[model samples]
Target: MQTTSTYKILVVDDDPDIVELLHYNLTKEGYEVEQAENGKKAIDTAVAFKPDVILMDVMMPVLDGIAACRQLREMPEFRQTHIIFLTARAEEFSEVAAFEAGADDFITKPIKPRALLSRLAAYARRDAQQEGLDEVIEIAGLRIDRTSYAVYKGDEKIILPKKEFELLAFLAAKPNKVFSRDELLNNVWGTDVYVIARTVDVHIRKVREKIGEEYIRTIKGVGYKFNTD
Candidate 1:
Protein backbone atom coordinates (compact mmCIF):
# COMPACT_ATOMS: atom_id res chain seq x y z
CA MET A 1 0.00 0.00 0.00
CA GLN A 2 1.18 3.54 -0.79
CA THR A 3 1.76 5.77 2.22
CA THR A 4 0.57 9.37 2.60
CA SER A 5 4.20 10.52 2.51
CA THR A 6 4.53 9.18 -1.04
CA TYR A 7 1.36 10.95 -2.30
CA LYS A 8 1.92 14.29 -4.06
CA ILE A 9 -0.78 16.99 -4.13
CA LEU A 10 -1.05 20.24 -6.07
CA VAL A 11 -3.17 23.00 -4.50
CA VAL A 12 -4.55 25.61 -6.94
CA ASP A 13 -6.42 28.70 -5.78
CA ASP A 14 -6.09 32.47 -6.20
CA ASP A 15 -6.51 33.14 -2.50
CA PRO A 16 -3.16 33.12 -0.73
CA ASP A 17 -4.81 32.13 2.54
CA ILE A 18 -6.51 29.11 0.98
CA VAL A 19 -3.28 28.04 -0.69
CA GLU A 20 -1.34 28.39 2.55
CA LEU A 21 -4.04 26.55 4.51
CA LEU A 22 -4.12 23.63 2.08
CA HIS A 23 -0.34 23.44 1.84
CA TYR A 24 0.01 23.40 5.59
CA ASN A 25 -2.73 20.86 6.18
CA LEU A 26 -1.64 18.56 3.34
CA THR A 27 2.03 18.61 4.36
CA LYS A 28 1.13 18.14 8.00
CA GLU A 29 -0.71 15.00 6.98
CA GLY A 30 2.59 13.78 5.41
CA TYR A 31 1.77 14.51 1.75
CA GLU A 32 4.25 16.18 -0.57
CA VAL A 33 2.63 19.46 -1.61
CA GLU A 34 2.99 22.21 -4.24
CA GLN A 35 0.97 25.39 -4.75
CA ALA A 36 -0.26 27.26 -7.85
CA GLU A 37 -2.14 30.55 -7.66
CA ASN A 38 -4.10 30.31 -10.90
CA GLY A 39 -5.21 27.83 -13.52
CA LYS A 40 -2.39 28.62 -15.99
CA LYS A 41 0.18 28.32 -13.24
CA ALA A 42 -1.47 25.09 -12.11
CA ILE A 43 -0.92 23.52 -15.54
CA ASP A 44 2.71 24.63 -15.75
CA THR A 45 3.39 23.45 -12.20
CA ALA A 46 1.64 20.14 -12.83
CA VAL A 47 3.84 19.46 -15.88
CA ALA A 48 6.88 19.63 -13.63
CA PHE A 49 5.40 18.38 -10.34
CA LYS A 50 3.26 15.57 -11.77
CA PRO A 51 1.07 15.47 -8.67
CA ASP A 52 -1.09 12.42 -7.97
CA VAL A 53 -3.97 14.74 -7.03
CA ILE A 54 -4.97 18.36 -7.70
CA LEU A 55 -7.24 20.55 -5.53
CA MET A 56 -8.49 23.36 -7.79
CA ASP A 57 -10.66 26.34 -7.03
CA VAL A 58 -13.46 27.04 -9.52
CA MET A 59 -12.94 30.74 -10.17
CA MET A 60 -9.58 32.44 -10.84
CA PRO A 61 -7.96 35.04 -13.07
CA VAL A 62 -6.04 34.27 -16.35
CA LEU A 63 -7.94 30.95 -16.62
CA ASP A 64 -10.76 29.38 -14.68
CA GLY A 65 -10.55 25.93 -13.09
CA ILE A 66 -13.08 24.41 -15.49
CA ALA A 67 -11.08 25.40 -18.57
CA ALA A 68 -7.88 24.34 -16.91
CA CYS A 69 -9.36 20.95 -16.07
CA ARG A 70 -10.55 20.57 -19.68
CA GLN A 71 -7.03 21.30 -20.95
CA LEU A 72 -5.47 18.99 -18.37
CA ARG A 73 -7.83 16.15 -19.33
CA GLU A 74 -6.67 16.54 -22.93
CA MET A 75 -3.09 15.88 -21.89
CA PRO A 76 -2.31 12.16 -21.92
CA GLU A 77 -0.07 12.34 -18.85
CA PHE A 78 -2.79 13.83 -16.61
CA ARG A 79 -5.57 11.47 -17.66
CA GLN A 80 -5.17 9.29 -14.61
CA THR A 81 -4.54 12.14 -12.18
CA HIS A 82 -7.35 12.92 -9.70
CA ILE A 83 -8.66 16.49 -10.16
CA ILE A 84 -11.03 17.71 -7.46
CA PHE A 85 -12.78 21.08 -7.73
CA LEU A 86 -13.35 23.38 -4.78
CA THR A 87 -15.83 26.23 -5.00
CA ALA A 88 -17.75 28.70 -2.88
CA ARG A 89 -20.68 28.41 -5.25
CA ALA A 90 -22.94 25.51 -4.37
CA GLU A 91 -25.10 26.10 -7.43
CA GLU A 92 -26.13 22.97 -9.30
CA PHE A 93 -24.76 24.40 -12.55
CA SER A 94 -21.34 24.91 -11.01
CA GLU A 95 -21.23 21.28 -9.89
CA VAL A 96 -22.40 20.06 -13.32
CA ALA A 97 -19.82 22.20 -15.10
CA ALA A 98 -17.04 20.87 -12.91
CA PHE A 99 -17.92 17.27 -13.72
CA GLU A 100 -18.27 18.07 -17.44
CA ALA A 101 -14.76 19.55 -17.35
CA GLY A 102 -13.41 16.25 -16.01
CA ALA A 103 -13.19 16.77 -12.27
CA ASP A 104 -13.00 13.58 -10.17
CA ASP A 105 -14.80 15.19 -7.20
CA PHE A 106 -16.33 18.49 -6.06
CA ILE A 107 -16.10 20.12 -2.66
CA THR A 108 -17.83 23.25 -1.42
CA LYS A 109 -15.84 25.78 0.63
CA PRO A 110 -15.51 27.34 3.68
CA ILE A 111 -13.16 24.44 3.59
CA LYS A 112 -13.40 21.91 6.37
CA PRO A 113 -9.87 20.63 6.86
CA ARG A 114 -10.81 17.33 8.48
CA ALA A 115 -13.36 16.38 5.81
CA LEU A 116 -10.94 17.29 3.06
CA LEU A 117 -8.24 15.15 4.64
CA SER A 118 -10.64 12.24 4.86
CA ARG A 119 -11.46 12.65 1.14
CA LEU A 120 -7.78 12.68 0.19
CA ALA A 121 -7.20 9.58 2.27
CA ALA A 122 -10.02 7.86 0.37
CA TYR A 123 -8.24 8.62 -2.91
CA ALA A 124 -4.99 7.18 -1.58
CA ARG A 125 -6.74 3.95 -0.56
CA ARG A 126 -8.40 3.70 -3.99
CA ASP A 127 -5.01 4.08 -5.67
CA ALA A 128 -3.53 1.28 -3.60
CA GLN A 129 -6.43 -0.99 -4.53
CA GLN A 130 -6.05 -0.16 -8.22
CA GLU A 131 -2.39 -1.18 -8.28
CA GLY A 132 -3.38 -4.84 -8.29
CA LEU A 133 -5.91 -4.64 -11.14
CA ASP A 134 -4.40 -4.08 -14.57
CA GLU A 135 -6.73 -5.08 -17.35
CA VAL A 136 -8.05 -4.38 -20.84
CA ILE A 137 -11.64 -5.03 -21.93
CA GLU A 138 -12.50 -5.25 -25.61
CA ILE A 139 -16.25 -5.40 -26.15
CA ALA A 140 -17.94 -5.14 -29.51
CA GLY A 141 -15.71 -2.60 -31.31
CA LEU A 142 -14.63 -0.68 -28.20
CA ARG A 143 -11.28 -1.24 -26.54
CA ILE A 144 -10.96 -0.09 -22.90
CA ASP A 145 -7.35 -0.20 -21.74
CA ARG A 146 -7.07 0.11 -17.96
CA THR A 147 -3.27 0.21 -18.06
CA SER A 148 -3.04 3.34 -20.25
CA TYR A 149 -6.51 4.75 -19.31
CA ALA A 150 -7.20 4.89 -23.02
CA VAL A 151 -10.20 3.91 -25.10
CA TYR A 152 -10.37 3.12 -28.80
CA LYS A 153 -13.40 2.28 -30.86
CA GLY A 154 -12.28 0.36 -33.90
CA ASP A 155 -9.85 2.81 -35.63
CA GLU A 156 -10.89 5.96 -33.69
CA LYS A 157 -9.32 6.87 -30.37
CA ILE A 158 -11.72 8.30 -27.81
CA ILE A 159 -10.73 10.48 -24.88
CA LEU A 160 -12.81 9.95 -21.74
CA PRO A 161 -12.17 11.60 -18.43
CA LYS A 162 -10.93 9.36 -15.59
CA LYS A 163 -14.24 8.71 -13.82
CA GLU A 164 -16.14 8.08 -17.03
CA PHE A 165 -13.45 5.70 -18.19
CA GLU A 166 -13.59 3.76 -14.92
CA LEU A 167 -17.38 3.50 -15.00
CA LEU A 168 -17.28 2.22 -18.57
CA ALA A 169 -14.48 -0.22 -17.87
CA PHE A 170 -16.26 -1.65 -14.81
CA LEU A 171 -19.42 -2.33 -16.80
CA ALA A 172 -17.52 -3.72 -19.80
CA ALA A 173 -15.52 -6.10 -17.65
CA LYS A 174 -18.74 -7.91 -16.75
CA PRO A 175 -20.71 -7.74 -19.94
CA ASN A 176 -24.50 -8.28 -19.65
CA LYS A 177 -24.39 -8.04 -15.85
CA VAL A 178 -26.60 -5.22 -14.60
CA PHE A 179 -25.21 -2.84 -11.99
CA SER A 180 -27.30 -0.30 -10.09
CA ARG A 181 -26.20 3.30 -9.56
CA ASP A 182 -25.28 2.58 -5.93
CA GLU A 183 -23.35 -0.53 -6.91
CA LEU A 184 -21.36 1.40 -9.51
CA LEU A 185 -20.69 4.22 -7.06
CA ASN A 186 -19.36 1.80 -4.45
CA ASN A 187 -17.22 -0.10 -6.95
CA VAL A 188 -15.91 2.76 -9.09
CA TRP A 189 -15.90 5.82 -6.82
CA GLY A 190 -15.67 3.76 -3.62
CA THR A 191 -17.98 3.91 -0.59
CA ASP A 192 -15.74 6.42 1.18
CA VAL A 193 -16.47 9.16 -1.39
CA TYR A 194 -19.86 10.86 -1.02
CA VAL A 195 -20.98 11.09 -4.61
CA ILE A 196 -24.70 11.12 -5.43
CA ALA A 197 -26.43 8.43 -7.48
CA ARG A 198 -27.03 11.02 -10.21
CA THR A 199 -23.28 11.20 -10.71
CA VAL A 200 -23.33 7.66 -12.02
CA ASP A 201 -26.04 8.66 -14.50
CA VAL A 202 -24.07 11.68 -15.65
CA HIS A 203 -20.89 9.64 -16.11
CA ILE A 204 -22.80 6.95 -17.93
CA ARG A 205 -24.22 9.54 -20.32
CA LYS A 206 -20.79 10.97 -20.98
CA VAL A 207 -19.31 7.52 -21.59
CA ARG A 208 -22.08 6.68 -24.04
CA GLU A 209 -21.54 9.99 -25.81
CA LYS A 210 -17.88 9.18 -26.37
CA ILE A 211 -18.19 5.44 -27.05
CA GLY A 212 -21.70 5.31 -28.59
CA GLU A 213 -25.02 4.36 -26.97
CA GLU A 214 -25.02 0.81 -28.21
CA TYR A 215 -22.36 -0.37 -25.76
CA ILE A 216 -24.34 0.41 -22.59
CA ARG A 217 -28.05 -0.16 -22.26
CA THR A 218 -30.41 1.38 -19.70
CA ILE A 219 -32.68 -1.02 -17.77
CA LYS A 220 -35.20 1.76 -16.87
CA GLY A 221 -36.24 0.93 -13.28
CA VAL A 222 -33.15 -1.04 -12.27
CA GLY A 223 -29.83 0.32 -13.59
CA TYR A 224 -27.48 -0.29 -16.56
CA LYS A 225 -25.82 -3.22 -18.25
CA PHE A 226 -23.09 -3.42 -20.92
CA ASN A 227 -24.69 -4.91 -24.01
CA THR A 228 -22.89 -7.96 -25.36
CA ASP A 229 -25.50 -9.12 -27.79
Candidate 2:
Protein backbone atom coordinates (compact mmCIF):
# COMPACT_ATOMS: atom_id res chain seq x y z
CA MET A 1 0.00 0.00 0.00
CA GLN A 2 2.98 2.30 0.56
CA THR A 3 4.10 4.28 -2.49
CA THR A 4 7.50 5.71 -3.41
CA SER A 5 6.46 9.07 -1.96
CA THR A 6 5.84 7.45 1.41
CA TYR A 7 9.25 5.76 1.61
CA LYS A 8 11.79 7.76 3.61
CA ILE A 9 15.40 7.50 2.40
CA LEU A 10 18.54 8.62 4.21
CA VAL A 11 21.53 9.27 1.98
CA VAL A 12 24.92 9.48 3.76
CA ASP A 13 28.22 10.44 2.17
CA ASP A 14 31.11 12.77 3.01
CA ASP A 15 31.27 13.95 -0.60
CA PRO A 16 29.01 16.94 -0.97
CA ASP A 17 28.58 16.33 -4.68
CA ILE A 18 27.55 12.67 -4.25
CA VAL A 19 25.13 13.59 -1.50
CA GLU A 20 23.64 16.34 -3.60
CA LEU A 21 23.42 14.06 -6.65
CA LEU A 22 21.61 11.30 -4.76
CA HIS A 23 19.33 13.76 -2.99
CA TYR A 24 18.35 15.30 -6.29
CA ASN A 25 17.73 11.98 -8.01
CA LEU A 26 15.90 10.34 -5.09
CA THR A 27 13.66 13.34 -4.46
CA LYS A 28 12.88 13.45 -8.16
CA GLU A 29 11.73 9.83 -7.83
CA GLY A 30 9.16 10.93 -5.23
CA TYR A 31 10.94 9.59 -2.11
CA GLU A 32 11.15 11.68 1.06
CA VAL A 33 14.92 12.17 1.29
CA GLU A 34 17.38 13.31 3.98
CA GLN A 35 21.14 13.68 3.82
CA ALA A 36 24.07 13.23 6.27
CA GLU A 37 27.70 14.17 5.75
CA ASN A 38 29.15 11.52 8.01
CA GLY A 39 28.30 8.33 9.86
CA LYS A 40 27.88 10.08 13.24
CA LYS A 41 25.54 12.58 11.71
CA ALA A 42 23.82 9.69 9.94
CA ILE A 43 22.89 8.08 13.23
CA ASP A 44 21.59 11.34 14.63
CA THR A 45 19.61 11.98 11.45
CA ALA A 46 18.26 8.43 11.37
CA VAL A 47 17.01 8.67 14.94
CA ALA A 48 15.00 11.74 13.96
CA PHE A 49 14.11 10.88 10.34
CA LYS A 50 13.62 7.12 10.88
CA PRO A 51 14.21 6.37 7.20
CA ASP A 52 13.03 3.06 5.78
CA VAL A 53 16.12 2.82 3.57
CA ILE A 54 19.67 4.09 4.14
CA LEU A 55 22.22 4.56 1.34
CA MET A 56 25.59 5.04 3.08
CA ASP A 57 29.15 5.37 1.94
CA VAL A 58 31.78 3.21 3.64
CA MET A 59 34.41 5.81 4.49
CA MET A 60 33.32 8.87 6.42
CA PRO A 61 34.49 11.24 9.18
CA VAL A 62 34.06 10.42 12.91
CA LEU A 63 32.62 6.93 12.27
CA ASP A 64 32.75 4.69 9.21
CA GLY A 65 29.72 3.08 7.61
CA ILE A 66 30.50 -0.39 9.03
CA ALA A 67 30.64 0.93 12.58
CA ALA A 68 27.55 3.03 12.00
CA CYS A 69 25.74 -0.03 10.65
CA ARG A 70 26.76 -2.12 13.68
CA GLN A 71 25.52 0.58 16.02
CA LEU A 72 22.26 0.88 14.10
CA ARG A 73 21.71 -2.90 14.09
CA GLU A 74 22.06 -2.92 17.87
CA MET A 75 18.99 -0.73 18.10
CA PRO A 76 15.63 -2.50 17.93
CA GLU A 77 14.08 0.29 15.89
CA PHE A 78 16.49 -0.19 12.96
CA ARG A 79 16.47 -3.95 12.98
CA GLN A 80 14.12 -4.17 10.02
CA THR A 81 15.39 -1.08 8.25
CA HIS A 82 17.17 -1.65 4.92
CA ILE A 83 20.83 -0.59 5.24
CA ILE A 84 22.47 -0.70 1.82
CA PHE A 85 26.14 0.21 1.52
CA LEU A 86 26.82 2.49 -1.42
CA THR A 87 30.60 2.69 -1.59
CA ALA A 88 33.53 2.57 -3.98
CA ARG A 89 35.15 -0.23 -2.01
CA ALA A 90 34.79 -3.46 -3.94
CA GLU A 91 37.16 -5.66 -1.96
CA GLU A 92 35.78 -8.98 -0.79
CA PHE A 93 36.74 -8.27 2.81
CA SER A 94 34.95 -4.92 2.71
CA GLU A 95 31.83 -6.62 1.45
CA VAL A 96 32.14 -9.26 4.19
CA ALA A 97 32.55 -6.58 6.85
CA ALA A 98 29.51 -4.71 5.59
CA PHE A 99 27.41 -7.87 5.77
CA GLU A 100 28.79 -8.66 9.22
CA ALA A 101 27.73 -5.19 10.27
CA GLY A 102 24.18 -5.95 9.11
CA ALA A 103 23.94 -4.35 5.68
CA ASP A 104 21.05 -5.65 3.58
CA ASP A 105 22.77 -4.90 0.26
CA PHE A 106 26.10 -3.59 -1.07
CA ILE A 107 26.61 -1.51 -4.19
CA THR A 108 29.97 -0.55 -5.65
CA LYS A 109 29.58 3.04 -6.71
CA PRO A 110 30.04 4.76 -9.95
CA ILE A 111 26.54 5.69 -8.87
CA LYS A 112 24.25 4.25 -11.51
CA PRO A 113 21.05 6.05 -10.73
CA ARG A 114 18.79 3.78 -12.75
CA ALA A 115 20.11 0.56 -11.14
CA LEU A 116 19.79 2.09 -7.70
CA LEU A 117 16.25 3.13 -8.39
CA SER A 118 15.38 -0.40 -9.56
CA ARG A 119 16.78 -1.88 -6.35
CA LEU A 120 14.80 0.55 -4.22
CA ALA A 121 11.66 -0.37 -6.10
CA ALA A 122 12.40 -4.06 -5.45
CA TYR A 123 12.69 -3.32 -1.73
CA ALA A 124 9.35 -1.56 -1.79
CA ARG A 125 7.70 -4.54 -3.42
CA ARG A 126 9.30 -6.96 -0.96
CA ASP A 127 8.17 -4.85 1.99
CA ALA A 128 4.61 -4.93 0.79
CA GLN A 129 4.68 -8.73 0.45
CA GLN A 130 6.21 -9.18 3.90
CA GLU A 131 3.53 -7.09 5.51
CA GLY A 132 1.02 -9.77 4.61
CA LEU A 133 2.91 -12.48 6.45
CA ASP A 134 2.17 -12.71 10.17
CA GLU A 135 2.98 -16.12 11.53
CA VAL A 136 5.17 -17.71 14.17
CA ILE A 137 7.27 -20.86 13.87
CA GLU A 138 8.19 -22.56 17.12
CA ILE A 139 10.39 -25.62 17.13
CA ALA A 140 13.32 -26.92 19.16
CA GLY A 141 13.02 -24.10 21.71
CA LEU A 142 13.44 -21.50 18.99
CA ARG A 143 10.58 -19.10 18.30
CA ILE A 144 10.55 -17.10 15.06
CA ASP A 145 7.95 -14.35 14.95
CA ARG A 146 7.26 -12.76 11.61
CA THR A 147 4.94 -10.11 13.03
CA SER A 148 7.51 -8.47 15.31
CA TYR A 149 10.65 -9.81 13.53
CA ALA A 150 11.78 -11.30 16.83
CA VAL A 151 13.52 -14.55 17.55
CA TYR A 152 13.93 -16.39 20.85
CA LYS A 153 15.82 -19.44 21.97
CA GLY A 154 13.95 -20.71 25.00
CA ASP A 155 13.35 -17.58 27.12
CA GLU A 156 16.41 -15.65 25.96
CA LYS A 157 15.81 -13.26 23.07
CA ILE A 158 18.12 -13.27 20.08
CA ILE A 159 18.31 -10.28 17.81
CA LEU A 160 18.98 -11.14 14.18
CA PRO A 161 19.43 -8.65 11.40
CA LYS A 162 16.62 -8.66 8.84
CA LYS A 163 18.24 -10.91 6.23
CA GLU A 164 19.54 -13.42 8.75
CA PHE A 165 16.16 -13.55 10.48
CA GLU A 166 14.38 -14.14 7.18
CA LEU A 167 16.80 -16.91 6.22
CA LEU A 168 16.27 -18.70 9.51
CA ALA A 169 12.51 -18.25 9.39
CA PHE A 170 12.32 -19.55 5.82
CA LEU A 171 14.21 -22.74 6.62
CA ALA A 172 12.37 -23.31 9.88
CA ALA A 173 8.99 -22.76 8.31
CA LYS A 174 9.55 -25.67 5.93
CA PRO A 175 11.38 -27.87 8.44
CA ASN A 176 13.37 -30.77 7.01
CA LYS A 177 13.10 -29.47 3.46
CA VAL A 178 16.36 -28.81 1.71
CA PHE A 179 16.72 -25.46 -0.05
CA SER A 180 19.57 -24.77 -2.43
CA ARG A 181 21.43 -21.50 -2.23
CA ASP A 182 19.70 -20.24 -5.37
CA GLU A 183 16.30 -21.19 -4.04
CA LEU A 184 16.93 -19.43 -0.76
CA LEU A 185 18.11 -16.38 -2.68
CA ASN A 186 15.00 -16.20 -4.82
CA ASN A 187 12.63 -16.85 -1.92
CA VAL A 188 14.29 -14.68 0.74
CA TRP A 189 16.23 -11.98 -1.13
CA GLY A 190 13.77 -12.08 -4.04
CA THR A 191 14.56 -12.30 -7.76
CA ASP A 192 14.72 -8.53 -8.06
CA VAL A 193 17.80 -8.29 -5.85
CA TYR A 194 21.18 -9.50 -7.11
CA VAL A 195 23.14 -11.27 -4.38
CA ILE A 196 25.93 -13.80 -4.68
CA ALA A 197 25.43 -17.40 -3.56
CA ARG A 198 28.09 -16.96 -0.88
CA THR A 199 25.93 -14.34 0.76
CA VAL A 200 23.57 -17.12 1.70
CA ASP A 201 26.43 -18.98 3.38
CA VAL A 202 27.41 -15.88 5.31
CA HIS A 203 23.86 -15.33 6.54
CA ILE A 204 23.42 -18.99 7.45
CA ARG A 205 26.58 -18.98 9.52
CA LYS A 206 25.50 -15.83 11.32
CA VAL A 207 22.09 -17.32 12.02
CA ARG A 208 23.66 -20.47 13.42
CA GLU A 209 25.94 -18.37 15.58
CA LYS A 210 22.94 -16.69 17.15
CA ILE A 211 20.35 -19.51 17.23
CA GLY A 212 22.80 -22.43 17.59
CA GLU A 213 24.06 -24.80 14.87
CA GLU A 214 21.85 -27.69 15.90
CA TYR A 215 18.72 -26.51 14.15
CA ILE A 216 20.09 -26.13 10.65
CA ARG A 217 22.03 -28.94 8.99
CA THR A 218 24.23 -28.76 5.92
CA ILE A 219 23.47 -31.59 3.51
CA LYS A 220 27.04 -32.30 2.36
CA GLY A 221 26.62 -32.20 -1.43
CA VAL A 222 23.24 -30.46 -1.41
CA GLY A 223 22.18 -27.35 0.52
CA TYR A 224 20.58 -26.91 3.97
CA LYS A 225 17.54 -28.12 5.84
CA PHE A 226 16.02 -27.54 9.28
CA ASN A 227 16.65 -30.40 11.67
CA THR A 228 13.32 -31.01 13.31
CA ASP A 229 14.69 -34.01 15.18
How accurate locally, in lDDT, is each candidate?
0.89, 0.90
Candidate that scores best on lDDT: 2
Sum up the clashes in candidate 2: 0
Query: Candidate 2: what lDDT?
Result: 0.90
TM for candidate 1 is: 0.92
Worst 10-residue lDDT window for candidate 2 reads 126-135
Worst 10 residues of 1 by lDDT: 126-135
Candidate 1 per-residue lDDT, tens place, 1-229, comes to: 5589988999999999999999999999999999998999999999999999999999999999999999999898898889999999988888888888888998999999999999988887776776677577787888888777789988888877778888888888889999999999999898878766778888889888888889999999999999989
Give the alpha carbon lDDT tens digit for every residue of 119-145 in model 2.
999888877787777578888788899
Output the TM-score of candidate 2.
Answer: 0.95
RMSD to true structure for each model, in Å: 1.7, 1.4
What is residue 52's positional error in candidate 1, in angstroms?
1.0
Error of 2 at 145 (Å): 1.0
Please tell me which predicted candidate would have the highest TM-score against the true structure: 2
